[model samples]
Target: MDELIKYAKENRRLLHQVPEVGFTEYITTYLIYERLSQTNFNLYVGDDALDIDRQVGLPSDDVMANTYQRALDYGVPCSFLEKLHPYKTGVVATIDTNQKGPHVVLRFDIDALPIKESNEIEHVPFKEGFQSKHDGEMHACGHDAHAAIGISVATYIDEHIDELTGKYTIIFQNSEEGVRGAASYAKKGWLDDADYFLSGHVGTISEEVGTVGATATNFLASTKFNVELFGQSSHAGSNPQDGNNALLAASAIALSLNTIAPHREGATRLNVGILQAGQGRNIIPDYAKLECESRGETTQLNEYMFERAKEIIENGAKMYGCESKITVEGFAPSATCSKEMIDIVKSATVSNDAVKTIVDEVSMDASEDAAVFINIVQENNGKATYLIFPYHLKYGHHHPSFDVDEAVLEVAITTFINILNELK
Candidate 1:
């Protein structure tokens, strides 16, 4: 157990030093592959594990090339990068005990946020010399810790193979920030045969280092989309009338999207996070792009909000004589944890010495791509649940100074191991 703790902490810090976002996790993928290669699990990486046709929200070709080059410069071998070339970045490992028991699937997300890390002297990572090396990326959401726990769990399973029954499938997912990536594997039937599916996140509900939440309920359904408006460019000061003014159309759509009426049936939300238009101060912008999202307490409500937003965007573009296109970057539907699965988590937590409290239920109140996988497993009549490992945090998730108490890693590791034991 002490060795697992040491392994978890070291790998967490190592992952923290290089934060990559979404589908561009080149260096991150290579490191995960290298670590798991020493275990007994049969590994399926990148192109082999995920369905390429199901990928969403990939960056442009130039961005992919630059990130791939960066991975090379970071000393990652081209041989590994070649396997994940052009936007394939994740791993799936399976070990079949062939002992006549349930098949368990565990998921861990490995993507980072685009936020830059704080370099304040008091920041733990900065002081410990493990802050992110990349300028515009950081694991502000504790995914580094999640990935570390996953690696440790894989090693633990290998070491304790004699005592465990059934089979284990561990998924290291990428591009979870926008509720993307999981669908690729889920659509490919990764969780179709799963008898028990388990996944968790760190520190959103529980407030203490030793607390564990057995069930994360009421996940909001969400849709992330990008809208592009095209128009002719002209001089603003002279021939402004000749241009269709895509920037104006974008501004109108952004304002109209926020005015969408809330559904009385449930909670609803809409936001235009990014809107880029107008290349210069005096130029009538010919192109505009807006990154936006919609959320609801239920799937039906989310569709209500998204459909309304789409109508506004299309009409707003037509009003300005600009052509409009809407593309779905990512999506996740809402799901509830099964009582059977919730009991399984509680049973596992009760035996863990590192766990101080067991939360029967907590509201996620947010979107998670894991819901895609969870829904797929449930649809096939398998039980599934999402757990939460609470830890002390200096800042909320997605903040530049966000850091978790390393002590929580022990709770996470033991809880997962105990859960496996319960399945027997």
Candidate 2:
């Protein structure tokens, strides 16, 4: 157990030093491959593990090329780099015991956020010399710890292969931060063969170190989209009327979007996170771009918000005689955990001394791409659940100062090992 904790910690710190955003985790993928390749698991990479056509919200081609080049400079083998080219960045591994039993699948997200890290000396990572090396990228959401726990569990399973009976599938998913990556695999029917499925997060609603949550409720359905408005550019002083003002159109649309009525049935949210327009003070802006998203407690409500948002954007652009293009970059459906799986999680760790408390459920009140995996498994008549293992957090998720208590890493690994044993 001590050695396992050490292994998880080492991997987590190493991952912390190199953070990458969704759909472009080149170095992240390379490091995971290097660690898991030594084990006996049957590994699948890139297009072999995903249906690329289903993927959305991918970075631009230039961004992908630069990230791949960075990975090469970081010493990733060219042969391995070839496997992840063309915007594929997920890894899946499976082990068959050749015994008749359940097929259990476990998923772990491996993408980082775009927020820059705090360089304060008091922060544990900064104090320990493992602060992020990449500018404007940090693991502010604990995915690094999730990936480490996953690798630790995989190695544990490999060492105890003779003691476990069921066929096991492990997924290291990418682009989960934006709710984009899971669909690539889920739509490909990756979870169709599972008898049992499990996935979760760290330092969510709970804040106690030894607490484990069995189920999550109220996962918000969400859609991320980008809008571009185009108009003719002209000199502001000479021909203001001839040039349609895309910037003015975008401003009106953003105001109307924020004023959309919330669904009476449940909570709804909308945000225009980014709005860029205009080239110079003397020239009329010919183009404007808006990065926005809508969310709701349920899918129907989310559609209400999205549809209304679209109407506002389109009509707003037309009101200014501008062309509008709205593209959906990512989406996640609302989901809930099965009671049977929740009970299993509770029973699996009931005897573990490390787990001090087992809560039946908690309000997630956020979006998670893991819903893609959980929903598919349940729809196929298999049991699935998204658990929460809480820890002391320095700041809220996606914040620059966000960090997790290292002890939670071991708790997560131990809990999964117990659950796997129970299923076996």
Model 1 lDDT tens row, 122-227: 9999999999999999999999999999999999999988888889999999899998899888866778899888889888843888888888888999999999
Q: What is the Cα-based lDDT of residue 94 in candidate 1?
A: 96
True lDDT of residue 163, candidate 1: 87
CA lDDT, candidate 2, residue 330? 94
Instruction: Locate the minimum summed-lDDT window of 10 residues in model 2.
Output: 184-193
Instruction: Tell me how many residue pairs clash in candidate 2.
Output: 0
Model 2 residue 394 CA deviation in Å: 2.1
Task: Provide the TM-score for each candidate, comma-separated.
Answer: 0.97, 0.98
